[model samples]
Target: QQQVKQSPQSLIVQKGGISIINCAYENTAFDYFPWYQQFPGKGPALLIAIRPDVSEKKEGRFTISFNKSAKQFSLHIMDSQPGDSATYFCAASWNTGNQFYFGTGTSLTVIP
Candidate 1:
C-alpha cells in the first residue's frame, strides 16, 4: 500500500520563483518526514525535513512545512533555479528510520 501520497506528479517553475510539493500520510506512528531530490543517475539525497513536533524547518532555499494534525507536509523551494530541476520525493519513517514509506514522486522543471 502507498503509505505516503504526493501530488502534482510534475511541476514547472520560473527561475527565482517558488516551487511547492505536497504530501500526506495516514500513519501517525511516523515520526520523521524527509524530502529527497534526485537527478538522472544519482540516488535520492535528503533535501530538507521536519519532525512532527516542528511546524516548519528551513535550510537555505529549501523549507519543509509540516502539519501534524492534518498528517500532511510540504516542501517549498525558494528562489528556484534551473539547477534545482530534479525529481522530488516525500518519505515517512518511524523512530528507527530504517524503513521508509515514499511517495510516488514529483518531477520539477525550473525554467529560465
Candidate 2:
C-alpha cells in the first residue's frame, strides 16, 4: 500500500475564508507526512509537516491535522488570500525511501 488520494480535485474559496483539503494513504509504514505548495511553473515547496507521533502541526496560516489510525490527514489554510492560490499536494515517505508518494493534487483558488 503506497498510494495517497486527495480531494476535491479543485477548490475556490473566498478571500479571508478557510480552505480545507483532505488526503488519505494506504501505507502504514510511511513515517513522514508532508504537504507541498506549488505555484505555476515552480516546484513544490514544503508547506508544513508532521510525523505519525504528532496529532497536529501548524505554521503561520497553514496547519496540518493528522490521524494515524485512519491513515488520513488534512490541510487547513486560515484567512485564505489570493496569493495563497496554488496547487497543493499531500505526500508521504518512509525514512528509507528516496521517493515520496503524492496525491493527485488539489488546485486552490482564493478569490480576491
Candidate 3:
C-alpha cells in the first residue's frame, strides 16, 4: 500500500524564488519525517527533517513543516536556484533506519 502521497509530480520555479513540495501519509505510527534531495546520477541525501514533536524545522534554505494531527508535511526551499533543481522526496520511518515509506517524488526545476 502507498503510505505516502506527494503532490505536483513536477514543479518549475524561477531563480531566487521559493519552492514548495507537499506530502501526506496514512500511518500515524510514523515518527520521523525526512526530506531527501537527489540529483541526477547521485543518491538521495538527507536535506532536512522534523519530528512529530516539532511543528517546523529549518536548516539553511531548507525547511520542513510537519503536522502530526493531520499526518501531513511540507518542504519549503527559500531562494531557490538552478543548482537546487533536483528530485525531492518525502519519507517516513520509525527512526530505526530499518525501513522507510517514500513519496513518488517531485521534480523541481529552477530556471534563471
Candidate 4:
C-alpha cells in the first residue's frame, strides 16, 4: 500500500506549454501528498503539495490537483521552460516514516 506510480516516464514539451503528469496511490491512510522536482545529479526538492483535506493547491507556476476519492493526484506546470527541463517525481508518505514512496521518475524536456 506504500506506492505511488507516475506515468509518461518522460515528457517533451515546447517552451511556454503546459506539462502534465499523473500519479496514484493505494494506501488510503496516507495523509500528506507532495510533488518533487529534481535537477540533474541533485536530490528532489518539494515542488508543491496538498493534503487530503484539500482538493487542490497551487504555487506560482506549479499546481497540484488531488482527488481524495480516487486516491490520485496530478502536477501541472504552467509556462514550462527549458530551464524547467529536469526530472520530476511524485511522492507520498505518512508523517511517521520520514520516507516517501516515489514514482519511477519523469524526465521532462522543455524545448527551446
Per-candidate Cα lDDT values, in order, are: 0.95, 0.95, 0.93, 0.90
Provide the lDDT at 82 for model 1. 99
* Top candidate, metric TM-score: 1
**Model 2, C-alpha of 103: deviation from truth (Å):** 0.4
Off by over 4 Å in 2: none
Which lDDT tens digits does candidate 1 get at residues 1-112? 8999999899999999999999999999999999999999999999887789989999999999999889999999999999999999999999973798999999999999
Tell me how candidate 4 scores on lDDT. 0.90
Off by over 4 Å in 4: none
> What are the root-mean-square deviations of the candidates from the true structure over C-alphas?
0.7, 1.3, 0.8, 1.4
Worst 10 residues of 3 by lDDT: 92-101
Ranking by TM-score: 1, 3, 2, 4
Selected candidate, larger TM-score, 2 vs 3: 3
lDDT of 3: 0.93
Which TM-score value belongs to model 1?
0.97
Clashing pairs in 1: none
- Model 3 misplaced stretches (Cα beyond 4 Å): none
lDDT of 4 at 31: 89
Evaluated at residue 49, the lDDT of candidate 2 is: 88
lDDT per residue, candidate 3, 25-106, as tens digits? 9988899989999999999999988889999999999989988888899999999999999999999998576598899999
**Candidate 3 C-alpha error for residue 46, in Å:** 0.7
True-vs-predicted CA distance for residue 35, candidate 3, Å: 0.5
Q: List the residue pairs that clash in candidate 2.
A: none
Cα lDDT, model 1, residue 30: 96
